[model samples]
Structures are given as C-alpha cells and as structure tokens.
Target: MTTRDALKIWIVEALSALGPSTVPRIAQHIWENHEAELRQSGDLFYTWQYAMRWAGQILQNEGKLSKAGPGRTWMLI
Candidate 1:
C-alpha cells in the first residue's frame, strides 16, 4: 500500500491499542511498531511523523475517526 494508506491503517491500529491519542503519540506508536516498513519508504520516511497528522485529517474527513477536547486527541469513531 501507499504510504498514506499504510499510515491510515497504522493510525487505526494505534488508536485501537491506545484508545485515544494525540498526533505525536500516534506517530510515535507507528514509528515504534512499524519502523522497518516505514524505513523501506526511502528518504520520505523521515517525513512519516508529519504525515501522520495528514492521515488523521483524512480519517477525520472520512468519518472513520474523530478529534476531541482542547488537545485535539484522536479516537476511533
């Protein structure tokens, strides 16, 4: 799958594991869990953390996830 698709899946999985999380927390989880695969994405892999936020935005738009509270934490819908 493309990086974006993979990121969306990772985000969902992270949320399932952690219940709800901030963007950085989700990003860290994805990095810790999928570092090898993410590294395979080449130079762009360095930007994966930032890409998680975009993935969150896409998920939010698709209504598969939601943001809550002042911290804008994310959780499954």
Candidate 2:
C-alpha cells in the first residue's frame, strides 16, 4: 500500500488502541510501530506527525473518525 494508505491504517489502529488521542500521540504510535518499515521502503519523506495529521483528515472526511473537544484530539466514530 502507499505510505498515506499505511498511515491511514495506522491512524485507525492507534485510535482503537488509545481511544481519543492527540495528533502527536498518534504520530508517536505510527513511528514506534511502522517507522522502520516506511523508512526501508523509502516512502517516509514527511515526518510521521505530518502523515498522521493527513491520515486523520482523510479518516475524518470518510466519517470513520472525528476530532474531539478543543485539544486537537481525535477519536473513532
């Protein structure tokens, strides 16, 4: 899958594991779990923080996730 696609999946999985989380928390999870694989594939041009933000936006657009409260937290729908 493309890096964005991988990131999107990671976003969902991170939410499932952590409930509502801020962008940084999700990014950290992605880095911890998938950074090596993404780097090996030469697809990690952007930081995991950026990738997670984009993925969260995509999921929000799809109605599978939502931003919560005021702290820039995201949660599964």
For lDDT, the strongest prediction is: 1
Looking at model 1, the pairs that clash are none
How does model 2 fare in lDDT? 0.79
lDDT value, residue 63 of candidate 2? 96
Candidate 1 residue-wise lDDT, 6-74, digit = tens: 889999999999988888788889889998898888765878777878888899999999997459989
lDDT of 1: 0.86
Instruction: Give the residue spans of candidate 2 off by over 4 A.
Output: none
Which residue pairs show backbone clashes in model 2? Answer: none
- lDDT for each candidate structure: 0.86, 0.79
TM-score, model 1 to reference: 0.89
**Residue 3 error for model 1, in Å?**
1.6
Worst ten in a row by lDDT for model 1: 1-10
TM-score of each model, paired residue for residue: 0.89, 0.83
